[model samples]
Target: MAVKVAIFDWDGTLVDSVEHIADSLHQAATELGYPALERAAYRNIIGLGIEEALESLYPGITRADMQAMREGYGRYFFTKATTPREVFAGVTEMLADLRGAGLGRAVATGKSRRGLDKALVSSGLGVHFDITRCADETRSKPDPAMLGEILRFYRIEPDEAVMIGDTIYDMEMAQRIGMPAIGVEWGVHDQDTLAAFGPKAIVDSMADLRRALELL
Candidate 1:
């Protein structure tokens, strides 16, 4: 099917928030008396839900600790962290091009609903998307549930939409549901790692991504 909608991943895909996320995770861990992990370890979990990411980083953590960590991460990320988290370069123009082409735009992200909402406002990109799904509202990445919800909302088939993200989890979920995927190289995962999931194309910049979508 020809593409009717473009579903995007938020953190590393559209916004350059990976480092800020890692720093916030580190602060949260430290606040909870958890051992510090390298930044790369935190980056690797960027595409998963906060709870899932926390679990992976600190395995065997108690439920109470998980709750505390989640709260701390949110506090640090939203209020305390000083790192700038802006939309990727040319992303606004790329989104405008997609809109002009009559394609519906949406976000399928690992961020919580609260986080995504705040980001949409702060980034001034909220007006571009017609719909959005958050990990807290649905299943996290690597599962097709959230994608399914977006498809249902748009009333389109899996093949009628494209999933654009920077992680294997995003591609895996799209592949599982028979949706086409495009990977961005500027995110947490490298090109080879993203390619392993079989995206239609892995782009290096917003211009390249727009060209890839045009060809699709």
Candidate 2:
């Protein structure tokens, strides 16, 4: 089936912000008297929203404290941390190509509205997305509300859309909604795990991604 819309996951898929994310979480954890998370564990839990991620990483932490930590981390990352978020190579070209082909593009992420805005501004790829869905405005990944809403808003059928992500949540969201998915290898999750989701295709590099979408 042809793909008319391309929905992307922001964090691990388009931009490599895992280090910034880990640093922010580590600072938050330290301030909250909790241990820092390992990079791999952090990557695995990132698709969940802040509250869920906190609960998963720091079991027994109070909800209020977790909320406070999230606030503190967001403040630090947005204001203090100017860490350069590295966009995958060829992303700009790929987006341009997709747009030239008349494909729609949007983002569905677990990042809060404020956080998503900050990252997009920092990454300089904000203009590439026609619509951006944040956790604050919609249900988080695995819930499929984010994807469903984007599809509805654009008047695109699920079969006419494809989700491109680096994590399982992206795959699950697409699968649950009956949309095609293309798992990117450079993102957070293991390529093997992404392949297990039976993606219509899995891209090893951004160039490969261009070819995959072209074929679609």
Give the best candidate by lDDT. Answer: 1
Candidate 2 C-alpha lDDT tens digits along 51-74: 878888888889789889998888
Query: On a 0 to 100 scale, what is the lDDT of residue 20 in model 1?
Result: 87
Q: Each candidate's TM vs. the true structure?
A: 0.96, 0.93
Query: What is the Å distance of residue 213 in model 2 from its true position?
Result: 1.0
Per-candidate total of colliding backbone pairs: 0, 0
> Residue 108 in model 1: shift from native, Å?
0.0
For candidate 2, list the clashing residue pairs, or say none.
Answer: none
Q: Candidate 1, which ten residues in sequence have the lowest lDDT sum? A: 79-88
Model 2 TM-score on a 0 to 1 scale: 0.93
Q: How high is the CA lDDT of each candidate model?
A: 0.90, 0.82
| TM-score quality measure for candidate 1 | 0.96
